[model samples]
Target: MVAILAADVAGYSRLMGSDEEGTLSHLKALRRTHVDPAITAHRGRIVKTTGDGMLVEFASAVDATRCAVKAQREMAERNADVPQGSRIEFRMGIHVGDIIIDDNDIFGDGVNIAARLEGIAEPGGVCISDDAYRQIRGKVDITFDDMGSQSLKNIAEPMRAWRSRIDTNSSTVESVRPTTETAPPLGLPDKPSIAVLPFQNMSGDPEQDYFADGMVEDIITALSQVKWFFVIARNSSFIYKGRPVNVKQVARDLGVRYVLEGSVRKAGGRVRITGQLIQAETGRHIWADRFDGELADVFNLQDQVTSSVVGAIEPSLREAEIARARCKPTERLDAYEWYLRALPHFYTLNRESLDKAIVLLGQAIAIDPHFALAKALAARCYAWRNPQGWATVPEEEKAIAVRLGREALQDGDHDPSVLWMVGFVMWQLRVDPEGALELYDRSLSLNANCAQALALRGWALATAGRLDEAVPALLQALRLSPFDPEAFFTMSALGCAYLMARRFDEAFKWTSRALRQRPTFAPALRFHAVCLVKLG
Candidate 1:
């Protein structure tokens, strides 16, 4: 009659290693304030809350996922300041099958399967049975990468699973690729990367811009304070400002793997803001909310938003990192380091750096061409070669890059990195704007943390003369990586958009800001030069 969701807090014992009382206090606070309310809102019932975990029953899977994501997002944010090792990460499993209800309890094989699935879930992540994944695919704007059928403890049949760490809107959202090839290299130490998209300046008064602009800065600062997180610098993110972009492009441009974004609206004495936390690789909306409050509560509003974002992101990040750490190297392989080094090179669009990347990637592929990162990066190098003017007669190189990029996707497009690289290559090389756009869009649907993908898509939109749509994407890129090298791109694009729309004065102002950051950066320099010419 009901589906069961079983989840246990990862590192619960380690977190309570020497401070049982403190852990209990935090957990108790979480339950009373976040968990209980979310469940009630979603029309679900909590069967029990164990000291380290909880079991809940839902009449429908949709509400169950919504409640679970909400609980995880809030709790993780609350614990952002805690030491990394002491943080609590929850792994959840959902199973829709027959269940038995007793006084104050729910019992069934469904519960056991759910627990097993939870055991397999990435920390701060969700794993659902094929039954559950199938049920909710199109019902909600979320995404999942298939884990294939794997044998679980209680379920004899192969259990189909998906990683639910990222939101459906992540520009970098992607599922694990399905293939029988040997495991590819693991890249980078698993610190989480995220971008915060710009908040729409919904205030009717054009002068209220400062509040909207500052909100993202405040968010970036709050998110960066968590020691466990690897927040992107603000500069790189601005590249996406005022531009429409898919999430995957955001992830690519910033060299980060994750992204976060929201909007702000101030009217009268009250302000309303809507926020969502997304996994860049998987464009899934892991957590989202619309909050309304008086302007006087600005501090509280910022804090609450930070809490939710940190809560939603940290656990999932830890889980992803832990998964990487847990992978064992194959014979004659140092896959982890190889993967780590590849991320930076793969995102490199410069000629010299990309050339170097090609050599290293070839080595990686030779060692394990099955290495997903290597393939993706190689494709990216080719994709960006010509437009970036990185190569002489880039046409040949561009074709090669496109061929290899799709090859990489076919090899394992589900991995966030691989899919993101392929998508980037398609946009920069083939100029198949539609195909590129779809891939970029799909990437974010899987993860919202992909600021690079978002930025790229934003630029694509701007170049195509779609000024109105480009604004939010570029703004998001700025929020996620306030200090990214490419942030000026977003600023310049916003300046350009303002110009195209005949908002001349605004264009001049933003272009001037961009010039301050990088006087010689072509995009900003050109835009700024033009503004001066037009104004004079």
Candidate 2:
């Protein structure tokens, strides 16, 4: 009796079609260097090889199973850095039974069963028959998922199958171990990147876990549609579920700069979701908040949580990017990097920092003329300078800002960030309220989770004396971004909307809320002082 292992490259034809030469080269090198050596070390003999697969025979079921698991695990590590669409993965199956050997090539029911099992295994995974599982059960330090009976193709009887789980700590040290003290970090993308960790279920019922998982999945899907963001896939993020994880390590592993983690709790027919966004590299908490709603409206509650979480995360990531920029000298950074460093200076609303922001933004634009976000932000500085009484020639600066804003919109109309910023420049620099409102509406349509755009639309409506129209958008923005970096902006907008509606008490309440978030925020302070004076 011999343990027969059969393996096939999943999607081999598709891979070949994408890059035929590269695929053939990689596959051949992998077999020569890793697969053959592993088999030899485990006392297995290659029976035959096909263009896209191979068959091997081992003296014992345990050795065959070990070799398969180790090979699959190593293959995963090898493909970790490969682009998702092009990465090569394998599905392996093992079976143990009597085989008829002819001309040193094995043949029989054993090889047929193994091939059928391979058809049912997952990519980057291993599956074994009942006979092989029974032989290897106590011999190896690995666990198998009972896949139940699988009706394999061209097989007479249903075969009981067990799939091997990727053991994170498998003893395949030589191939699977970290290469150095600092394992290679995933490279960051051109734009901001983030990974949403699986939310913990705190409801004390495993059944409620699905609700939390569903929420995260929806958030991931929503975030992916934001265009500028590079969101990690759900399968990669969920691997950390049920494990105590280090946020920084996860960020490095996933190659994301930001991480979002939270928990779901349900009690007495109400659901509560608490989430926190973290700057993984710096170990800083950027924002945190909680939402509560009745279970009867679970779907709406999920939407609320998703919008709020998305809204909060954008500003949090922006702030973290600003902080990072401040750490390095502006001269040392490139166009996009310098632009990121300039944001904190602009947000401080001070004369000196605002000037500094414009200068940095200028350098960014010079480096990359087509950089739409940099252009939009630079235009904003010009627009903002007039309001701060810092621009010596206000009309000239306004014209320049409008020109840049239009240029940004030319290529970046589809980008939510560009639309929002350009809209702000339009309103503040050119005083084109109609144009700003149109842009904001377009932005919201593109990204429903755009809290800042919603807040800006509210502010615009309130300032134009459309209180009823403004109030709902402002309140929704606040609900979505409770810990927003621009909390004062949202709160003050809500207050102004209420003030325009002749609700003086509610106006005072929201203005005070803004003050609580940022004691000296100019807009909030003005709103609070105005509300108090109205009451007097």
Per-candidate clash tally: 106, 0
Candidate lDDT scores, in order, read: 0.67, 0.75
Candidate 1 residue 209 C-alpha distance from true site, Å:
41
TM-score of each: 0.41, 0.44
In Å, residue 104's CA in model 1 sits off its true spot by: 55
Q: Write the per-residue lDDT of candidate 1 for residues 67-129, one digit (tens) a residue.
A: 777777766666556544456667888888898878888787888889988876766678888
Model 1 regions more than 4 Å off: 1-336, 344-350, 515-520
